[model samples]
Target: MARPVWSGALTFGLVTLPVQMFTATESHTVHFHQLQRGTSDRVRNKRVNERTGDEVPLDEIVKGFDAGDEYVVVEPGELEDIAPGRSKALEITGFVDLEQVEPIFFDKTYYLGPKGKEYAKVYALMEKAMAHTGKAGIATFVMRNHQYLVAVKAEAGLLTLHTLHWADEIRDPRKEIGDLPAEAAVTDRELKMAEQLVETLSIDWKPEEFHDTFQEQVAKLIEAKRTGETVEKAEPPAASTNVVDLMEALRASVDRAKSPKDRRGQKAGGAAKTAARSTARSKRPSKASSFDSLTKAELYERATEAGIPGRSSMSREDLIEALRGARGRRRADAS
Candidate 1:
């Protein structure tokens, strides 16, 4: 089991439950080391005194506040002395309906687990109560020397903590973004078509359906470089032109979304299958775009649906080829 990132007691009024927090999500972004171009030498960063041009040791570093024509140097120890006490507890200040909280206020999320078997009953009670009432416990706590505002809600029989930005942290969009259109009237026909287009494309939320295509491409590029293979560049997608007619765009979108897939037969002749494939690509009816435009996960799903053998071990290119082959077979059989 993974170790908990934070362990603290959660308290509200007279009730207290010892719990541990674990990060609920993780990023899969590819990281690259800084290096000189065309060379293997790594570039390193150092903290140096601007005036003296000398490297500074970690122990010698001190934060300073800029005052008028001077500075107020402060030591790490001084900051620690005045820092918010780490009480090792998430003290709930209030309980409010979850709907009252805006999504923009939420930041990171953590899974809350009972610290021990003895605490499970109390934890379950709190979780059930919150879930039943559709309320979240708003709390403030200090962790890693930083104070955070968080909302605790029950989900899937477990407590989930969502850290939120303080009220002052959110910027007013009107102040930051200038000259926003106040209103643009839409014709009833256009509105109806747009709503229909939305309805046609909407699907139940399935996070597994999405994948980070850019990261997969980066991994593929790295693998190609390691194997001394030539990397092929994909053509950029055509830039979208401004929509002259809202109704026309909405109608086209709805049509594309509703288009049925072409059925070629598994036993069809090679020439017939090739023509079918060409026709399919030409239509590009919302789903027949090239492999480059799709995520690795999307390609994997296609491979799975096609019943491609050994797809689990295949690379992106291999998956694409396997899917194409499967489509050809299906087309031939249908014919």
Candidate 2:
């Protein structure tokens, strides 16, 4: 079970409900420790005094702000003293239509649950009410000595709190971004073609079908290095479409999207040609050279043809090994 990060009372219009907050998301990215060059020793950071060149203790460290000439120092205990009641309470100012809140304002999310089983009814009632009305409660609270603007909404039969950026934190894109094109830059014909392309490529949202291919490649690279093997480098990015060929590019993209089977057939044809070449070369008494010359995609195609289980998850080397094992099994059956 996950432990709650905070426990507090949620107040709204004279009603108080005890609740707990838990982080809603976690990261899975691979992490590496900093090390000294040409050595396995780990590199670490420490707070040190500039003039004396001595390592500073945590208890002695205080927050400082640079003024004109000197520094203004503040103690950590002073911050807590000022936020006396905010740490223990989450007060909802008002409810607003959920759709009114722009996605740009949202930051982190946390799950809000009843502090005890006794307060389950109140929690459920709030969640159901907000879910039905399509409203979110705008709230403010202090956590870890930082104040956060937040929105509490009902999601998947539970209340979720999302931290929001303060109004001043948002930047004006017009002032921040340069060289943005005007609407008049696009021709009517190009706009229609672009719309058509979008329509042709539209599909229902299915997040499960997508994954982090870059992370998968990183894992494969690590495994390959550990096993003293080389992993294939990724293909280079395609050249940018020229403005003169914009219409032609849009037309070609629409045509390709309209006929997905044609694209699949092209890939299948390439794989079939590779297989045929391999078979023809096998009779020349050079069997070892056949699979080694094929690319990873070609090997994957052959694995697919052989109906190898778990081939989709296999690396290029794994696919080659599996294909070899399959070929040997077939030869044994034939004999």
Candidate 3:
């Protein structure tokens, strides 16, 4: 069995429990090696001294900090002497409501449990208290010679540790993001129609429902190439691709959502699509004009079906104008 990464005491006031920490999550990413194009030679990197451009000898290196132009090198015993016992003690300073910590602050989590029989009662007490109060203990501990801000929480009838970020680690998102329009300018009728459209499209959050289509395609292409199949090189994805129109995009999304994968059961694909669309104007609709061909009356009816805001008060012209304009804007601005 693998040895625990950390062994410590979970102490708050008079109570203390000896515990061991083990990793909670495992990763399954495929790893790759840098190989020569024509030969099977593998590539590797070495630490080189910047000034001399020579490989640095690891044994000779010492931990150091530069203050202005001067350097302060420390011995192996120095760090442990200056700050110790943090490794052997997960000192809980305080407890706060779990909701106070946002998802962003957490880095990684690990499991913590009693190290031996003597600590079982104390371990159980702390875990039960955290679970009952729905609070997490704000604590600090050392692991692999590095200090971490840790949160002790109850998980599956046991205590779990989550490493947290230091104050300077998190960046404020407002720095990169501009303010967005919180309220729509559309009438109640248009809003109601949009709501109905949303209802028709809504689904539970099943992560497996979606897959990275590009990645899956790439994997398929690679498999074919490996099996000696002749294949054309795929085009690279464009950076900042051109946008699709709003009404068309939304309509496409709705159609895809409602259409049965087994084509036999589809009811709306026949005459209704023709009534909403004008196929007679041109044998082939230039992509941009198809959205425009949908009459103001069709747009309003669709919006009404979608449950857009103030549907009863808005005229047919108003509803069509609003839906088309909003959908177009949405398509253009979509990332």
lDDT for 163 in candidate 3 is 99
Better of 1 and 3 by TM-score: 1
Q: In model 2, where is the ten-residue run with the lowest total lDDT?
A: 260-269
Residue 137 lDDT in model 1?
98
lDDT preference between candidates 1 and 2, better one: 2
Give model 1's TM-score versus the native structure.
0.78
lDDT of each: 0.79, 0.82, 0.70
Stretches off by above 4 angstroms in model 1 are: 85-87, 241-243, 261-335
Candidate 3's error at 179, in angstroms?
A: 8.2
Q: Residue-wise lDDT of candidate 3 within 148-225, one digit each (tens)?
A: 998999989999999999988898766756784456466564456557569875655655434344454555567888
Off by over 4 Å in 2: 260-335
Better of 1 and 3 by lDDT: 1
Q: Clashing pairs in model 2?
A: none
What stretches of model 3 exceed 4 Å from their correct place? 51-54, 178-225, 230-248, 259-274, 277-335
TM-score of 3: 0.64
**Cα lDDT, model 2, residue 116:** 90
